[model samples]
Structures are given as structure tokens and as C-alpha cells.
Target: MLFNIFISDLDIGIKCTLMKFADDTKLSEAVDTTEGRATLQEDLDSLEEWANKNLLKFNKTSSSSVERDLEVLVDNKLHVSEQCTAVARKANRMLGCIKDTTSRAKVITPLYSVLVRPHLESCV
Candidate 1:
């Protein structure tokens, strides 16, 4: 997640790691620390940066499953997908007779201001 932290915090940490790896053309020291993983994923997830960097990938055949946040996984895979969709579909059908706007944006804005907008701005 993007955070509005001082750029020095990110830039120095990032520049140090890049220089460390670049100094040794053979990559004698591998980055396997927690901080290293965070820096690597940040670079990989960045559109402009990742395209300019070398990619690292795993073979599908060599992949193994780890617990994933069901709502965030790509295309909704995992056993939870099946259960969530089934429940949601049934709930939607159950709501077929409803005609209401009581749960609309007008009623939700005050609550959302405290919950969502500030987080969005900070992240961006």
C-alpha cells in the first residue's frame, strides 16, 4: 500500500539496495530479508519500474498453495470463491422483491468520510 511517508525513507532504502546488488555484477549476496522482500515487491508491482527491471518468476509446476486473502486473489480462485459466490447468488435472489434506497449513498456518505476517503488519499 502506498503511504505518504517521507520520500527519504523509501528512496534511501531503495537506492541502497539497488546499489548493493549493482555493485556486484554477479549478485554474490542475495536479498532474503524482510526489508528486501518489501523493496522487491514494491518495485515489481510498480508499472514503470517493473517494466524496466528484470523479472523473477516461478514455474507453475513448482508452485504450491499458501493461504490467500480470498477477496484479493486473481479471478477469485480458491475454495472460498465457490462458497462466497454461492452465498451471494442465493442472497441476491432472496432480495428480488426489494425496492428501496435506504442503503443508498446519501445515507452512507457521512460514515464513509470517516472510513474511506482519507485512506485513499494517503495511499495515492
Candidate 2:
């Protein structure tokens, strides 16, 4: 598409990796050192410049310390405990609902697989 062609060279001369999917563009780099942080900032500046040159705009507010993708929450530090906890809580609630609805042991296994297992599996 024309949009893809226009931004295809957006990663040129950049040290970090650029992941472009649909309307989302993500820039990723390890920021373990001061130099690494500077490199990330430089990449951000380059992206802003590219947007300005192409007459495109970025939604600044969407840039956050934590981002959710594929039902997984990832923070800037790459911590996923919050995601695990959230998924666990959701699955627990589903289990509780199943418990309240049926006393049949055989039915619970099928219900759990259909209703609760996906959350546990996906978050891991």
C-alpha cells in the first residue's frame, strides 16, 4: 500500500528495532545503560522528525510506561507480574462462576477448558 511505501524506510539509520503492524509503530531498544537511553531518545526524535516531514501525526498520549498487547501487559521494564495477576484473577472469577452454576464433576472439566483455560494459557 501507499502508506507502507511511504514509511518503509522509517528505520533507516536507526539503531533500534522498529515494529510496524497495522496503524501501530513500536520502537524497541534495551535501555540498560545511559548510552542506551540516549539512543532510544535519539530514535524517538528521529521518528518525530520523520512524522513531521511526512505530514503525519503521532498520538502522544498513547505513549505510556505500560502497554498491553495480545492480552498481555508489558511495562517499560519488561515486568509481567501485573498481567499474570490480572489473568489469574479473571480465571478465578470464571472458576467461581462455574462452581456456583454446576455441582457435576464431569461438567466442570469441560466448562473449565472452554471458559477458563484460555486466560491461563494466553497470559503465560
Candidate 3:
């Protein structure tokens, strides 16, 4: 018999869904506590077992790349990727706006709408 693995958050009483696109699989959950972390770890272990049983293996390099990103987020407290920062700096400079200088309302509004709005909106 074949079955898909499902993860549940016992504390919040919600089930975590796994998303897959082609060969890419994503597992996400709101992990803010010890129990949540343990639950996620358990789910990962189960996934590894299931993959091995089905003759499927995760890409090691991709897994490590994701781990590095997670480490950066945890250590920095901000999900500021290289591309995002570059775009933000470019946006600020495009309209002759300094980082800390107070600019006129008209200039600031358009600068934000054109350059910064897309990056902020993309996160959501």
C-alpha cells in the first residue's frame, strides 16, 4: 500500500500540509516552541524513511542550501537575501534619495510605489 505522509501540530490542533512541484517538495509549519520543533523533526525522519522505501532520495546539495538559508534567518532575525538588499539599495538610489535623509512627500511616495512596493508585496 502507498500513502502520503501528513504532519499535525498537536499544540495548535492544525495539520501541516506538504507541497510538491515536480521533484521539489516543501514541508512547512509554525515552529515556535520545543514541541513544534520535535514534531517537525519527527515528520522529517518519517519522510526520509518513506523516501528510502520508495527508492527516492532527496538532493543533498539542495537540502544543504535550504539549511544554510534557514540558519541565516535564525541568526540574523531578518530574511534579507542578497537580491532583496540589492534591489532595496538600487531603489533608494534610483530617485536620488538618501537612506536617512528626509525627502519631499512627492518624491518618497513614487519611489516607494515603484521600487520598494514589489519586494514587500512579493513576501506576502
Candidate 4:
């Protein structure tokens, strides 16, 4: 049981993620389900023996991720996602600038019309 606790903790990283030990009583029960705490200690001792024999084999493979083996395939996908977000933000800003430019042009058009109106009146 103690070995299972150690294995679960090592494999899962966070004790909060262990569903089997959701509460204090569950954790206590898992640590020493047998006769006594000494039995749990003895189980840990045997686990050490087994690990020493086969631990090198386990360390050869990654304990973290499988994506590293497929890095080339995954890189373009991640790049595309980042590029899309950058382009979307740039497009949003571009549209805002275009709208503001159009609005200012509209305001200037009426002023231009007013100045031309008097000049045309005098020429006519």
C-alpha cells in the first residue's frame, strides 16, 4: 500500500490529483491497510529492492511526455495557432484604424464643401 502511495505520488505529481486518497481517512487507510505501520515500512523496503533491479529500464523512457517524439509534426500546428492569433489582433487594429480614418475624412468633406460653396457663389 505504501509502495502504491509512492508510485501514485511519483507518477501523478500532485497528491491532490489522487482520487483514491480524496480524504484524510482514505489517505490513512492507504498508507497502512495491513497489520501495522511496520508492515507498510517493510513493503517500502521490498519496493526499493525491486526498483534497484529494474529502475534503469524505467528511466530509459520518458516519465513526462510522448509529444517530444512527434515534435516536428506538432511544431507547425503550434506555429499556426500563434500566427493566427497575431494576425487576428492585427486585423482588428487595422479595421479600427480604417474606420477612424473614414470618420475623419467624412468630417473634413463637409468643411471642404463649405469653403468651396462660398468660392463658387462669388464666381457664379
Clashing pairs in 3: none
How do the residues 1-124 of candidate 4 rate in per-residue lDDT, one tens digit apiece?
A: 7645645533222222223433211112144444556554554445445457546222434343222222221232333343344445555565555566666777656654554344333322
Off by over 4 Å in 2: 63-66, 74-82
Model 2 Cα lDDT, one tens digit per residue, 89-116: 9999999999999999999999999999
Give one digit per residue, the lDDT tens place, for model 3 in 8-77. 2212322455665443567777689987888777777777776676677777553222223322322234
lDDT value, candidate 3, whole model? 0.55
RMSD of each: 15.1, 2.8, 7.9, 21.4
Per-model tally of clashing residue pairs: 0, 0, 0, 0
lDDT by residue (8-113, candidate 1, tens digit) is: 2323323233322211111112458977666566653452343234352323263444333322322323344544454555444434322232466665565445
Query: What is the descending TM-score order?
Result: 2, 3, 4, 1
My TM-score estimates for the predictions, one after another, are: 0.19, 0.74, 0.49, 0.22
Top TM-score: which candidate number? 2
Model 3 spans > 4 angstroms off? 1-15, 63-78, 81-83, 89-124
| Preferred candidate (TM-score higher): 1 or 4 | 4
Q: Relative to the true structure, how large is the alpha-carbon lDDT of every model?
A: 0.39, 0.90, 0.55, 0.41
**In model 2, which residue pairs have backbone atoms overlapping below 3 Å?**
none
In candidate 4, which residue pairs get closer than 3 Å at backbone N, Cα or C atoms, i.e. clash? none
Deviation in Å, model 4, residue 55 alpha carbon: 36
Q: Indicate which candidate wins on lDDT.
A: 2
